[model samples]
Target: MENISAAPETQIKETSFLSLNPSTLEVIGEVANTSREEIDDKIEKAQKAQKRWAARPDAERKEIILKVAEALQQNSKHLAAWITREQGKPLSGPGANFEMQACVGWTQVPASLDVPEEIVFEDETRKDILYRNPIGVVAAIAPWNWPLMIAIWQIIPSLRMGNAVVIKPSEYTTFCTQEMIKVINTVLPEDILQVITGRGEVGSYLTSHPEIGKIMFTGSIATGKKVIEASVKNMARLTLECGGNDAGIILPGFDVSKHIDQLFWAAFLNMGQTCACLKRLYVHENDYEKVVKALTDYSSHIPMGDGADEASILGPIQNKMQYDKILDLILDSEKNGADVLFRGQKPDLEGYFIPVTLIGNVDNGHRIVDEEQFGPVLPIIQYKTLEEAITKANNSENGLGASVWSDDLNEAQKVAAQLQAGTVWINQHGAIHPLVPFGGAKQSGYGVEFGIEGLKAVSLPKVISIKK
Candidate 1:
């Protein structure tokens, strides 16, 4: 049975922002846009609340994070439904349940972390200590893709370390994010964790606001640059995670049937909307044809339909602008002599459904290979040498994440070490843990998230010395 919701009527007059279910192109709900005055009020409140929050005992703060996790668990079903309705990620697979589980993990793991004071020096004559200090009010700008999960990654660490956070979720997925925040707020103090909703202008205002001490933003490279520009006026500490054209390489000798599913899904998770999803693939000549045929056969079985449908493993493109961009890239790739190895069916539906497309025999310089498509399209290139594959993978401006696949572990490890990305995976891609630190290199943006280092990213340090 198809577990899907029917489209709601198009009535957008009263809402400042209308959220559409990408699978059905139906209006999910209306959201209010924040004004400059309201933004000012929230910032001021956050500033005040941060001071009180920071003064609380570490035990008290930890308990609150745990409570928030419990609340999220209780409301998982409702939140998951909202996510599927607005974001178009199928509920059964990587949709709401997956996100909620991730959220719980992010919140609990960071809450459990303890950033103890570092004893720099200790002698009879003198003692030195370094401590992690909260950086007042933080403004977190989240993206449309993986809205709640990313927000949890941002907000939980900030709050756990005793800083108040003001979150600005993408307008595309605002309502569900607002609801997620609301659920957590039942366990948090007022203004300690607040939500601000609007378009880019609101984000610019918040980033530039003198009262906001730090900014954490996740989005496109173009917008990340703009965020850096706006934060300069306030000189706020910034942690920015921008775009990534992640690459995956298959070694010459690999079992195609055993690993093809991993290769295909890693590249197309969330319908290829994930920031660290493998956008490019390089296969050694010996394994090129075998890998192509295996991957094509694997993708044929995964159905694409409304996110609400339990049988649908993938959903529609989240928005029109991205849909058009993917189409442009595909047309350009065809013009550049790329051959199509596999193309999913083009459904007779109104929503923005682009079938999973794989173009083979492409070279590195092609736009399809160089740029971050951020859609359901991947370009697979054939390389004669491992060195050539490494060079081609590192050729792009982004170095967020990359992977090396091989049946031989030693050979895969040797090549994985050479890939110039923040995180390198062998036999897998984009799999991250809370205790491990993940960030970008090169133009992918700076500042790391996750682990004790991530807690320190949202905090400042103070050194104290005692002389005897």
Candidate 2:
């Protein structure tokens, strides 16, 4: 309910965009501000479009994907500029480029890739066969933090697997996604790949809507559970890539300095607005003080707040609620006997900024360590043996990602395997490749994104039998 609408930008293109800013809560775009009835129309259009899209050959469907890639690169500068203006992230660098990187990730399907027919023969008499076919209409509700990339992560795979997609982006950053879709619609039929704009009500309408064949979402777990409950009417296939308070273990080694640098990037990249950011860190007690000292010294050099200029390392907290929740968690951690080592402080009211905070003596129950802070905050807790460290790492309900750092690759590998997470890192953190599948276990939610598994998430299996 902050009606933060602004006067439309002069000469803005016509689209179903929303009037919201990525950093400062100002309304500065030409947003359609579509109603629920209008969205209902788009859904109907998408349903009709899917019939033709599904009727097309798989290769033709894949061609549209490559066309999307070409359009993205040609419009990369425009996209990056839009991202910076909308999200307030670094415009010319890593932050601005991820949207393009994500677009390129799905440009082409793997050559020589075959989802072969799987044949199951129990006895000589009966045979069961399985192959893959496309699901009908996919309803994708993506988060705003990384609007273009997250949307691409959801949209591209679903589209590539031959399913028509209907995307509902977070209200805060719908402009960027709408811009992304604008480029793709040039080559793709508007009905096949469409984006609808609105708040939670719009998303709720889509989730429970009977026409959708499946729901793939990325956001907080609370909302994720709601989607699951709402999907029961049609038993829609669901994949929830929820939250993560991911942990990292740094072992004593000669190159611990390098590992500390890696941790700094992971802890504060995108202003620590990452799901798999290294939130909880455990260092060997012998070198614990040294690691903290090195991190604090290095961290001080990296500035925070409003990453509009290319030189700034971190940006604003995306929105106000996230800005406050970060401060609240730090306070709760302090109340729970956690020591505040290095706390980032910026009093500029214009920038919704939270400093890069590091906490010490964090336990299993502390909010700083237990839940996903989703900010530029790092907490350090000490542990003795490898088992104790692994025990602490696996104690959380989140199993999204974890890491171990040591000069000894074997030791790091050993610890990495022991951590109960989807992706593990050795000597590095947040190093991701598009070809690798990543997700979480326990309360971290389900389903894998990227790599071969990602392609399969939106694909349905079918069996054709040949009997003689």
Candidate 3:
């Protein structure tokens, strides 16, 4: 999801911005800032085209979406390259290549899902049947963190439910989204899917448009509030997935050696930019020392450098604003007496590079612990008891996801039940399956996405009753 950092500069004289490579600060490409009139025109055309598209047989729609997924696979290398350049993720590991593969995989699953009519009640005297119908048009506002994959998350389900979509991707990754849409539109009918590129104003205008029936947004809590206000204008059906300061708890008797690698990637994936990544880690005091040492040793050996380099597993922060914010948070933590267990080497190159860092001797009230840093820094807080750990983990207002680490299945499941987050992981974190429904609790936002529930989110339900 998009960071709570500064919004892209508003378009004034120039109607475009240069997309830059975060690793080298080099220009990748330029994208036009879509105007209000163009957005209106696109929405109107989508409204007209959706009727005919929705009239097509369900099997035909499914076949077409499957073809789109095939097209994405065929073009995976090219698409992965764009993602590496526009967003600062490595080409290997769980980076650009992984994201491209996920895009294809996510698209196919929604196409294969069955949304059938349901018989609610049946009797000799009366009958009731329920149908899933398409909402007129869906507006998808995507974030830069996982631009292509999240767009597919929003678009594929909407199209499967027989609705046209108009997307507004984050300015930081607009061209990358455009490239993915370019591939998708080749297999789709004209006006069935479209992307409008620009700064925040373009997204605000798109969401507030009267013609939009349902809106899907993934971004910051600050911006999510704005989306909720805009939806009030039309009372648009909304599925909002906002920012998360997710926490992970390490049980007292858990073996730190066996799961160290899994735990490392869960937090540092995408340099800890993901909304659902573990932002704060609570370790029982009994296991705190061993856990901290193991994590530091594991993180020190990992490579961090330019994304295009095959040897690098991690890359620079995607933007300068975020890079600076991370530094500020670390500095504050140190000033507040948090111990720096390990800080990775910074390559002798010019870019937004901050290596892997693990902070210890931190507590719940520390700003680094309380706020969503959204970077490669993780603060480990120690707790005296399981109750204390659970209380600390549940203290955050953002409850998108949380994890409990332990070898005891029954004990872990019991701990997971007490967590207030939307989805609790027992032994893993940030591992999302396409078939499961995923959403947040509290201010993290509501409305689930993925699986049959996701298909229903993009469509409307109607009941038909008959007198026998």
Please rank every candidate by TM-score, starting with the best.
3, 1, 2
lDDT of 1: 0.87
Give me the runs in candidate 2 sitting further than 4 Å from their true place: 1-22, 30-34, 109-129, 345-349
Roughly what TM-score does model 2 have, to 2 decimal places?
0.90
* Cα error of candidate 2 at position 79, Å: 1.4
Using TM-score as the measure, the top candidate is 3
List TM-scores for all candidates, in order.
0.96, 0.90, 0.97
Instruction: Please give, for residues 346-421, the per-residue lDDT of candidate 1 as tens digits.
Output: 6667799999999997888899998899989989899999899999999989999999988899999999899999
Compare candidates 1 and 2 on lDDT and give the better one: 1
lDDT score of residue 272 within candidate 1:
96
| Candidate 3, 12-101: lDDT as tens digits | 234888888889998888878788778889999999889989999999999999999999999999999988888889997899999999
Model 2 clashing-pair count: 2
List ranges where model 1 is wrong by over 4 Å.
1-15
Which pairs of residues clash in candidate 3, taking residues 3 or more apart in a chain or in different chains? none
Candidate number with greatest lDDT: 3
- Model 2, 104-197: lDDT tens digits are 6645443113455677654555667887777878889887678788788888787777678889877777777788889878888768887877
Worst lDDT run of 10 residues, candidate 2, spans: 1-10
